[model samples]
Target: MQRVLIVEDDPLIAIDLQHMIHDLGYVTSGIANSFDSAKRLAPHSDLALVDVNLVDGATGPRIGQFLAGEFGISVVMVTANPEVVADGIFGVIGVISKPAQPATIKQVLEFMSTYKHQLVAHPPALRLFTCDRRGPL
Candidate 1:
């Protein structure tokens, strides 16, 4: 099972995400509400669902870059403020608008897991940097 890190500031949301991930058959590596906590949990995670405007301000992009670039983890931005990363960020797969449906989350997790381990070519419906189905690719 793949290990996922939830970088959300809201405790309720984080717990909800943890339960959801667990129910989806994935392991929850940990939850981090700040950059420091993210750094500590990075090595143990294979994928990360990050939120912007975290407890430490709008550092989701930075955290995503750090996790993806430094740790080679697959990062998907899960932020309500999708505009913040509209231009895309280095090392991030893409952004998922907040209040994501369980089906969307499931598809993304499946695509990412397969892509990471098997180098799968297709991406989920989300606006991935490599496979932008909604815009010019």
Candidate 2:
């Protein structure tokens, strides 16, 4: 199962995205309203649904960069801002428009399903962490 982390500030949206992830047979690791919580969970996540703007106005691109570069988690950016996605966005595998629908979220999962192996640091690393999903993580 894919260990997915949601980085959305809106509680309802977070819940909805979490459900969408589960429907796709992926497990949600956590919910992060800000970049800090997101970064803290990146080490364990395989896929991330990152919002472009957080509570503090910080952008998700920063979080996306960290997830891909440091933690190796695949990132899917959800944004309504064109400028936010403009010119040389890196690390994220795909972009979804804001108010992301179930289908859009599903597509993101499809994009991430390919990298589920990275969700775990290593085969033996499973003994070192607790996975939210069943099976060997």
Candidate 3:
């Protein structure tokens, strides 16, 4: 099972995401409300569902870049303002507009599991980002 880390500031949303991840048969590595907490849990995570705005301000993109570039973890931004990361960040696979539906999350996980973060045909619910000239790796 994929070990997922929820990088969201809202406790309620984090809890809901945790439950959804569990229901989908994935492991909840941890939930982090700030960049410091997220860094601490990055090593143990396989994937991260991140929010653009957090308790520490707009640090989700940085978190995603860090986790994906440093730890080789797959990163997906889940935020109310998807436009913030519309241009994309290094190591981030894509952006999922909030509120993300259960079906969308499930499909995202499945796609990530199958592709292992490779740039390929992605789920329609996910807005793919152009991480680099070659695309997300």
Candidate 4:
């Protein structure tokens, strides 16, 4: 199953994401509220729900980059930051708006579930496998 990390400082949001992941057929791998903790914990996830603004600062873009670029974790940036700054999250599969709707969340989770690799400390570096390539590749 897809393993997910929640990098949201808001406990309620994190818990909601956890519940949603369960409903979507994934596991809650970990949760972090800051950039440092997210960095340490992200490598363990196959995918991540990253908030652009953290309890400490705006670290979601960084987390998104690190998770996707370094660890091969599929990052779905969940934030209210509709600014172009959202464009900076390289290697990210999607940029989801905050207060995620069940429909949108399910869409992203369904996107992730198609991949076959099991989540571990670090997923294998297969660029295509690590990405969301549509339509029977």
- The Cα RMSD of model 2 versus the native structure comes to 10.0
lDDT of 1 by residue, 29-53 (tens): 9999999999999989998999988
* Prediction 4 global C-alpha lDDT: 0.70
- Each model's TM-score? 0.89, 0.77, 0.92, 0.77
Model 2, 1-137: lDDT tens digits are: 77999998888888988888888778999999898899788877988878878886766878877787777787767766635565424666546666767776675576466545454222111111122222232
In candidate 2, the residue pairs with backbone N, CA or C atoms under 3 Å apart (3 or more residues apart, or in different chains) clash, namely none
Tens digit per residue, CA lDDT, model 3, 1-137: 78999999999999999999999999989999999999999989988899999999999999888888888888889999998887888778888989888999999988767665364578898987766323644
In angstroms, the error of model 2 at 114 is 1.9
Model 3 root mean square deviation, Cα atoms: 2.0
Error of 2 at 87 (Å): 1.7
Predict model 3's lDDT versus the native. Answer: 0.87
Better structure of 3 and 4 per lDDT: 3
Report the number of clashing residue pairs per model: 0, 0, 0, 0
Alpha carbon lDDT of residue 7, candidate 1? Answer: 98
Q: Write the per-residue lDDT of candidate 4 for residues 1-137, one digit (tens) a residue.
A: 77888999999988888888788777888899998898888767887878888988887777787887778887777777646453344566656667777777777766555543543232221112233322233
**Candidate 2 weakest lDDT stretch, 10 residues:** 123-132
